[model samples]
Target: MHSRKIYTNTKAIAWVTIGTALFSLIFASGKFADGSASPLQILFLRYIGGLATLLLVVLVRRERLSAYRSPKPLSHFIRAVFGASGGGALIYASANMPIVDATALGLLYVVFVIPLGVLVLKEQLSSQHFGAIAICCAGAAIVMASRGAFTEFHMAYVFPAGIAVLGAALLAVEGLMIKMLSHSDRTMTVLLYVNAFGILLMAGPAAMQWVPLSFESAISFILLGPIAVTAQYCIVQGYRLASLSIVGPVDYTWLIFAGLIGFMFFGEKPTLGVAAGSAIIAIGGIMLAIIKPPAGEHESTSSA
Candidate 1:
């Protein structure tokens, strides 16, 4: 039993690392697409591609169609809205902001989840959590202030950072919604509805900017859908195989990978402030992960 536990944990760590890399790659792809497509267009193609791929997976696996049914359509729709809006905002930010900065701001989702979880899940927060929140808030402010100073207050630099913060908040809300929905819905059911509503929500803007896709763009879009869906699955699998405290921190590796990709592929670099703020934010997050919640508080529930 001890050996089995060790193996499971090792597998979880590995899967979580892979999942983080995939998520970073997804952000990179969004950055790439930004040059050739608007966020709306990317959203439409991504969801359409994801929906189609998911449907194919279901069909090929002979999964029961009924498994897609959700008891709470309205709640799922809310999730869909949050998911699509957050995704669009992140992609826009990813395109406009330095990749490392974008990735750092996105990490605020973990911090935002603290307040969101309290409000939405009625989860209790301890003094330590409040302390973490304060630190996180300071870190965010520092990052923003640093960016503004570095850019000499350029809107071109500041706007996307602001949007990235907004996206992080939206993603936190989406995470809470997912927790609620998970109580009554299957994972696939939740995902299907997210993409379904995403298609509907993004279709209008996507159509307005409609242009024929080249073969390369078409292939990229097709692959993007499955890649994102697969990353989500890998995350789920990692969490399933290990404790949240063990695996959750691994998600932050996205920032490192994003920085590497940005520098190597996009000629972007991180500033000192970016590094400091990221460190502070990461420290707070790691504390949140390591500190045990009060007993009888459903601490087993994942934060996002």
Candidate 2:
């Protein structure tokens, strides 16, 4: 049993690592599409792709449509709203900011989770968690403040930076909602609803922003959904295979993968402040991941 548990955890870490890398690729694809598509357009394509992929999964598994129904439809709707908003913001930043910086900043969701856990999940708050949150916030500020020194201090950068931070907060809310939804909803059910609602909400803006895309860009846009869906499944499986304390830090590998990809593909380099800030934030995130809540306290371990 002990060896089996170890093997399972090792497999989980591998899956999470792959998932994180794929997530970086997904963001990179968004960055690539930035020139040819609007954020809404990218979001719409992602939603369409994700919805299609989930539908296929449901069909292949011979799962009834009703199996996707959630007891908490309202919670799913709220989760979808936040998920779409956060996703839109993330893609916006991907388009406007360096992939490494945007990816690092995106990790701030882990920081936001602490306070949100307290307020929304009713989880106990400890001094250590508060200290970690403070560190994380400071790191985020440093990353944003350092942006001007490396890049131009223009609204172009400012707007996306603000949106990225907001995206992190919104995603934090989604995490809380997912915690609640997990009790009664299957993973696929929650995902199916979120994508369905996202598609519905984004259709109007996506239609308005629609521009003719080259074959290559269109293919890239279509690919986002499969990539995203696969990544989400990998993350979910990873978490299911192992405890958060074991696999959580592996999720941070996304930033590293982003940094490597940005350098190779976009010739992007992080400034000293960006590097320092990201390190600080990573430290805090790892600390939070290792924290063990008191028995019976509802801690969020969802990687999605």
The most accurate candidate by lDDT is: 2
Tell me the spans in candidate 2 whose CA falls farther than 4 Å from its real position: 1-20, 89-108, 127-166, 234-255, 270-286, 297-304
- What Cα-based lDDT does every candidate model obtain? 0.68, 0.69
Candidate 1 Cα outliers beyond 4 Å, as residue runs: 1-20, 89-111, 131-151, 154-168, 234-254, 269-285, 299-304
Model 2 Cα lDDT, one tens digit per residue, 1-304: 4444445656766777788888788767656765678768877888788989999988998978897777788888888889878977876786687744565567777667556656764666567556655665666667666655235445567778888889988987775665556545666877788878888989987998888888877767877998887877676666555443444345455555666687788988977876887788667655555454445543233422
For each candidate, what TM-score against the reference? 0.73, 0.72
Clash number for model 1?
Answer: 0
lDDT of 1 by residue, 1-83 (tens): 44445566557657666877887777666578766866577667877788888899789978776778877989888878887
Each model's number of backbone clashes? 0, 0
lDDT of 2 at 192: 83
